[model samples]
Target: MDAQPDPVGEPAGSLDPRAELSEFLRTRRARLKPEDVGLPDFGRHRRVPGLRREELSQLAGVSVAYYTRLEQGNGRNVSAEVLDSIARALRLTDAEHAHLTHLAKPKLKKKQSGACAQQQQPVRPALRGLLDTMDSVPAYVSGWRTEILAWNRMAAAVFGDWGELPPQERNWARLVFLRPDYRDLFIDWEQKAIDIVCMLRMNAGRCSDDPRLASLVGELSVKSEDFRRLWATHDVKEKSFGVKRLHHPLVGDLSLQYESFRLTDGTEQALVTYHAEAGSQSEESLRLLASWGTDASRAGSSVRRTA
Candidate 1:
């Protein structure tokens, strides 16, 4: 099948939703097998990997030509029912299902001038206060571009002092790919790195015109071979609740659960909070770290008073 061309009159760096949707569908289809989906294999030689287009179409209860059109990026005004059927046939996770829907129906692009005028807004005062009050949990607010907008003292204590870095250097993707220390912090560094890039890819799909995000992706692609390889895979994922295993310089190995809450206000910022299970060794480590952070703050204040 011929590949779909880029949308006419679109800029070189702008995203093509149709192309994205096609690639996403193709890749997902490539990963499945006939046996995996409870289909019989007749030992027939196949030219391509995974289930054939006809097989997928049969499983999805759609005509092969119709399914092929969707996979080829020619299906316009695709109904939700069809998408849901396709999603079930592919056995997609919740995150993957949502991503498929986003690709199928991307938001209408805002004018370039309006988008360019947009800037990262400040975290609300109440939200800042909320972070301050969460002394026991390490929490931070991140912009849609994964920019570290605001972090609490506990967050600083756990994840280095992001405030010390320049605004451009405070991004999650930059920290993972550029900083050796941050890369070493995670136990599963390779997987963690891939997830970071995947999340960035998802962001790119949603806000392709964001100059800052585009610049960051370009910089990383140029600097890090790992980032370049992963970005080429076209993997996309949204950050959700998960367990993180990390080795901090001060604290030892810690296994923490993180939950991300979306802010109701217009901004797409999310409040990410990390906590250890009560009575677990990780909880003890967190307590020690919190105490150390508190003492360090007190000492700094005392020195300022003495001066």
Candidate 2:
């Protein structure tokens, strides 16, 4: 039987850096086999699922003792070259490699007062104006932890009005997992869940000390089994661009392609916009939805979900 996902034993958002690094490397190592690294797999029964410490160290050109200590969560003295070598050995993607580096060399946390820690990041007026100018495109600004800071009318029409939701509930993680209506809106709910969890994992590595993030992770871990399972996979990815299929209550169906651009405003905010292909049925449905304008309030009200 597969091992169960470890519980969020620490308080929400307060994951130990060492433990995070340890589990991430272990999960990554567990997915590989000796044959994967060109090593002969003798018919001897294996004691562990994936490559052993000696095998990985040999592949990475590092000492077995050092690799063992690093895998055991003592990565403080590890260098970038060693990390890069190990990343290559594990065949980690760019995003996964970056996540590993962050876990190993976390930035110093700034002291935050109670109010400052919980304060919401405001979308710049210029950025908000840019979102508004994208008339036909459904656009929104997301801050750290996938918080929906600002959105345009088209976005509200397709994804429900974030303006109506409390700031805490205006997050992608909360909307996708906590709200039943949002779950039903996605055609591939499992894929959507995986994407959201991957985003959260990225955020956890980047801002592991954010208490609000910890609290959100803790709450989701306790409330949603799907969240708990996906969270344990140690997957790290950014949803920079993708196609999403949705079963909109009013529009019937929508196939939208989205692009995410990072803002250069010295903050961790991204501008995400969605558009359907020109002259396609999805385009027509999107156009019709946009035409609903303020009237889409009715559809939003119909599918409004409560936590």
Candidate 3:
């Protein structure tokens, strides 16, 4: 009843999702402040930004080897009590904690046997209205898989072409690695790609058993070596609100601030919007983008999504 290698054993790409989950939980623990978790420091020379795996093991009252195995996704049949202890030690937020538990033991075996694990279907109409209301910032809604479900005119202008792609190919991960335009569009494409890999790692833990999620990974594995390597490393991170550099053909380059608002009623679908400070260069760039979008809007160039 536990996660195991299939007959002939699935390739690392197939079982790599578990490795991803483990790495994320382990990495998150490694990056925590001892003070945040009520742990006393020994005044040792700190060489790393986060807590050591040994320290995490001690805090969680588990053997270092055992914890290491968990992090590598080698050990299964973990107890809920231990998972709780690790969660507490990590000082994870409620959502993070729930996600951690889900990673430790997928819901498919029991919890998802009959219960409704899915959130509200698709993006809410009210949310779409809100996206339309935004004056200039590009706004869009995307599910956990980075399936871009909806977007406004400004968003349509920026990543507008993506909406024209098939749903399976429209995934942010795919676009970051597979699309030729990604390199030209992102000023810091490498960092952005790394960030997407990390974020996708976090999602992999929460949705490892989801068929759609599996399909996305399978498709990416077959098509993108970048995605394949990063997914194999099993890294995960949380990057919600931040500044990003973008290169637009019409507006040149600009630094934009963005915020990700998660909808509780949806399936962790997020609304991300980017804006420039009132007097920032990005503001001018955004105006140019808006102007371009207005022109596209007038042309009635509605991009139809693929898949």
Candidate 4:
């Protein structure tokens, strides 16, 4: 029997879990200080920024040699207890802890026999209908890799008509980094960038075998220096809820709260919706924006009919 070739046109290779685990541990360790970990801060010329390998090993109650091997990216023989102790020593958050676990013990991928190209994420028609019904809210459906699978008119009005963008350019990461208009749209662009990069980092941990994700990461790394810096930090964040402060060209300032709910259809799909506080100026602005979007949509429809 001969080995089969990988799927055709897979432009990027899968992320190396060993390398990811190594960098993740190193970055996490680099951010901590001896004093912060309740260890004695010896006033000496130190080459490294944070606690030494030996100090960390001692804190985790493991042999220096074992901890060193794990930090060197050999997590093949790591135990659950050891991982937990090391996570505590590193002061990892819930999200970071999960990311660390995923990196250290990634699930075995099933052998691929045929086409392995990334499939287009399917958005349920009902979900799309739901988005359309949210006339006063800006809502959209995000699938794996944060792809904008479907969106309502209000979302188009607030976030720019994603329908106008080619499918590949509809991602949040690309829009945030590659689009200049988005930089102006987001009042706190740096924070938005950080959040996006962190989300990608978390996704990378969970979906190491996703070739499209690998390609996306590679593209951003090559094209955006800011992305490169943030990616190197190995930070991870789970998207749940947040407040977005946007400077809409037509509506001025908008402070909108967004909530994301995971779809229960056994898919990695989430419905994200944004709304303004009740009786607030932002709420008034949102209503005005919705009206403007409706009018524009009507005018476009009329023009198409005339043509």
Model number with the top TM-score: 2
Worst 10 residues of 1 by lDDT: 1-10
Model 3, 36-101: lDDT tens digits are: 777788888888767878889999999998888888875367888888888888877665666666
Could you tell me how far off, in angstroms, the CA of residue 236 lies in candidate 3 after the best superposition?
1.5
lDDT string, candidate 2, 100-159, tens digits: 887887643322112224444577788878887887999888776777878888888888
Minimum summed lDDT over a 10-residue window in model 2 is located at: 1-10
Identify the runs in model 3 with alpha carbons over 4 angstroms from their true place.
Answer: 1-59, 63-81, 84-99, 108-120, 294-307
| Decreasing lDDT order of the candidates | 2, 4, 1, 3
> What would the TM-scores of all predictions be?
0.83, 0.91, 0.71, 0.89
The worst-scoring run of ten residues by lDDT in candidate 3 lies at: 1-10
Q: How many pairs in model 3 have backbone atoms within 3 A of each other, for residues 3 or more apart or on separate chains, i.e. clashes? A: 5
- Candidate 1 off by > 4 Å: 1-12, 107-117, 294-307
* Best model per lDDT: 2
Better of 2 and 3 by TM-score: 2
Model 4: per-residue Cα lDDT over 76-194, one tens digit each: 88888899999999999999988888788764322211112346446777777788789999888875576787888888777776665566777889888987778888999999999
lDDT values of the candidates?
0.75, 0.80, 0.67, 0.79
Could you give the C-alpha RMSD of every candidate to the true structure, in order shown? 8.1, 6.4, 8.0, 6.4
The worst-scoring run of ten residues by lDDT in candidate 4 lies at: 108-117
